[model samples]
Target: MGNRGGILPAVGALALLAACSAPAPAPVAQTTTPASASAKPPTTGPSSDAPALGPGPGSQPPTTPQPPPPNSPAEVTSACPFLGVTESSATMGVVLDAYAVEEAKTTQQDATTYHCTYASRTGGRQLLDLFVTVVPGTGQIPSLVTAWTKDCKGPAKPIGGVAGTTRTCSLDGADSGDVMVLVVKKSHGQTRLAELYVRPFTDEVYAKLAQLLTDRL
Candidate 1:
């Protein structure tokens, strides 16, 4: 009976050890939320409904619009200022009454010019063109004289007792019949150019007319 009792205790101890060593039911196979589902989604770019930005304070201001320039070389009244019809008729020995004038302005150079034309009253046989140019600065008169007398082939003959430098030239051509050009420069940088077309070109008459015009200038 003692040996059976010992055998029963040993069987009970084996059952207790087996129960302790069993693999703890495999931890129940846990289910949890994924990391991607738990975290916030990443942004793509700026929102389409956002407000637009304007120019900044440090940026340059808009430029102001400029005004346009005036029309150049426009015609004006046809009255002669320095010379008149009576004086031109007496000088050229013809009857002159008709007169016409045109004006031109150079804003860049700050200069103004007036072109006066005188014709005979009888048959328009005799004609004279006088151009008066005024520039504000000095050294501008020579260029005007050069431009006016560029077509004349005669040598420049200086005259005496004039306000400024005076020169006369007679052009040489059948098309340019009896053409005499006279250029006079005044003290205040003003220039007067005269182109005469008469039947007979007389130096004495041209000198007298030049004197009268320069005296008036």
Candidate 2:
């Protein structure tokens, strides 16, 4: 009985030692969850590359203005002042595109004047002045011619036109008839006096305009 009891204790001790000597199971690995695919991102401000909303507040509209129809009579008359005297009554050859017209009162007789400022498409600009005044007959003409002739280098001579006969005096330093001081008198069948002055560099147009004034007196 003692030997058996000793054997039993030895077996129990061996079992306890075996259980302690066994390796501990690895610690359970922790599982991690990834982010969701459908999640929304936070908003900051407007993007740098966003398209513009619309035109600026002070911008002009993007449209072109339509011009008047061709062969308008009013256009001919509008260009008549700067036109040569011969061309004053001309219907054709009037280039409305070359000019812009403005009207105002002149210093002489509160007269109505047409200032035709021409800007050439080819390149330069020139100003032509046409002044209109009234009188009882041709009596106001002699003094007018005298006034224009004072500064003229050329003799004042008869300038006949559709209106009537007057005179022109060349300015003291003018070149080959390019510019002259010209005057004319005429009644378009009435007693109103139409007198005009030419400064310099426009004689052909002046004579043309003068000759077309009246059919009668």
**C-alpha lDDT (0 to 100) for residue 176 of candidate 1:** 41
Please provide, for model 1 over 69-162, each residue's C-alpha lDDT reduced to its tens digit, 9 standing for 90 to 100.
2211232222145556566668767654444332221111233333443332332333554444443334445554454444445665554444
Compute each candidate's TM-score over C-alphas.
0.50, 0.40
* lDDT score, candidate 2, position 185: 42
Please give the RMSD to the true structure for each candidate, in Å: 49.9, 47.8
Candidate 2 residue-wise lDDT, 125-176, digit = tens: 2222232322223344444445433434667656544235555554334443
TM-score of 1: 0.50
The parts of candidate 2 lying over 4 Å away from their true place are: 1-97, 107-114, 119-123, 136-138, 160-163, 176-178, 181-183, 186-207, 214-217
Q: Which TM-score value belongs to model 2?
A: 0.40
Q: In candidate 1, where is summed lDDT lowest over 10 consecutive residues?
A: 13-22
